[model samples]
Target: MRVGKKLFPYPVLNNSKNNSGFGDSNYQLMITITQNENYFIIEKAYVEVENQDIERMLADGRAKAIMVVECSATVFREKYEIGIEPKDISIPIGNLNDKVEISSFIYANQDIEHFNSNDFLEDFADFDFSIEKYDILAVDDGYTTKVVFDEDKDKKMSSIFSVIKSNNKDLNVMTVSSENKQIVIEMPSQYFDYHDNMKHNDNFQNIFFAIIAIPALTQCLQEIKECFSDVYSMDINEVMNDKTWFVSIANRYQAVFGTELTSDEFIDCNTYEVAQKLLNCGSTKAIEDFYNLLWNGRSDSDDE
Candidate 1:
């Protein structure tokens, strides 16, 4: 995405040497995304350029603005002109995955010889400079937002539990470590090998979630609850400042439920509620998927 810079020879709106004559002029572009059904909806896509000169240029058809959106994961790239095209667009979820970056820019649609704005700097007020086509007059880096579908969320259990393999033959079947931010669950070689091998299989993944992730998360939440038992006076953020996993889950909780819990609520909430918020009902989803996978497999075998 193009960012406003000092590449232009003349005093552009964003240039450091831009004259104050274009008083109180600013450029802002905002783009936000939301998900609905099978589409990623662009909730907002608008540019607010507070400059009369630029507005006049746009009105006179000298300048054109466009918003560009790209999602590398799905190899989707599209652009919409500010006034000429629809701003709020919907992209099929099939055409999107992971991070979506949006950027907007205003540029000269056609070359203009001896272009000079009335608000040019004092030294160059009377001077004129040739403007070339596609010369960026203004730009906003815009913003990036993530799109996580149900399938994607189901596969993101690793964020809450950092499961690793333990090579020591004498170690317990599983060990939980919270010394670092993430709650690391170390499993002996045999169990870890089984998990690692079948992690990609949808049915096996559902089974692992039902067996391993649920129990590990339950324990992790219990430890957090106990850690703050005596410090109910302090904020949860302060108490778990070092535990990034807690922060991750808290943010996810808010994203899923559209509300943040008070520190007291975090401490007082039951383990089941905490689990639901943290996992976005992932446990129930896993159970359903597991049943479906088993039932579908049996039916296929019976048909054969």
Candidate 2:
């Protein structure tokens, strides 16, 4: 199935401008969202695990590893949190099946729970694995495009990079590994921080959707629909319209003045008047700030 809700991109590395090469702290915490059936699994689980340690685990039969998952809500803000599961589940503790795809990039594949212990390690070839998606937002960095997936694939996706880096010359992205099944993206880390500036609200579902899932995500979805619609079937249009792909701009028109509301309540209204009335009740200033944040990627701007 397609990714259900808006995904909080995995391994949000907050880079310090002081160091060109991000230190150990930057790589320690990896966050991600994966769609499991009806709900989205928000995974903020990571550990500074060593390779040899991971190898040792494989030798044992447990086939399980430690992980820290804060199963919080991403898109459905007022709805649910991980559905009956604890919000802050401790590390070395996550759904084993879910961690298989992402562990390669983080713990270097040691966290993966192979079905067949004997045959699993033997079949650990890189390219042999099936398709996976990744998004990387390189925060205020220069362009370094190392596809790491395929040489030719890198060349083909050059236009995608061009689309993302169109307006800003200052924020260029280098190589982010996509082989681990993620939609890796790069953006200024301030976007992740709550107190960054025009952040009237702490929630960033809209901003993340706009900035990270742009031409890259939509383009990938388009290609998948065209090529595999007949083979691996899905309702491409329905999922795409899940507000996860909506391009939100901070405009007075879209805002409803004097209302404290959530997105679910907005979506559930019946009549045009109800919807319009709802829109007329929200904080226009917050929307304006969000708008600037999404497009400009600067929370602390002179506009507000």
TM-scores, in order shown? 0.54, 0.20
Off by over 4 Å in 1: 2-9, 14-23, 30-32, 84-87, 120-127, 150-248, 251-304
* Residue lDDT tens for model 2, 1-304: 0111222222212233242122233322244544433333435443332233223532462222223222122111121112112233322222222212222122222223221112122223232222122222112121111111122433222122221112334644422222123334444344323223523443443343334433344444344335433545444223322222211211221454434333433333333333222232123333654777788874432221
Q: Which regions of candidate 2 deviate over 4 angstroms?
A: 1-181, 188-205, 214-216, 229-304
Q: State the TM-score for model 2.
A: 0.20
Output the number of the TM-score-best candidate: 1
lDDT of 1 by residue, 1-304 (tens): 5453435566566522242333346666766677886898886677777777677788899998888888776788898787533368778887776567778777898997887766665766888878889987766667766654456453344665778999899997788777545678899999888888887665555456656766677787777778777665666655444565665677666776688866766777787656744654556666666677777761111110
> What lDDT does model 2 reach?
0.30
Clashing pairs in 1: none
lDDT, residue 77, candidate 1? 89
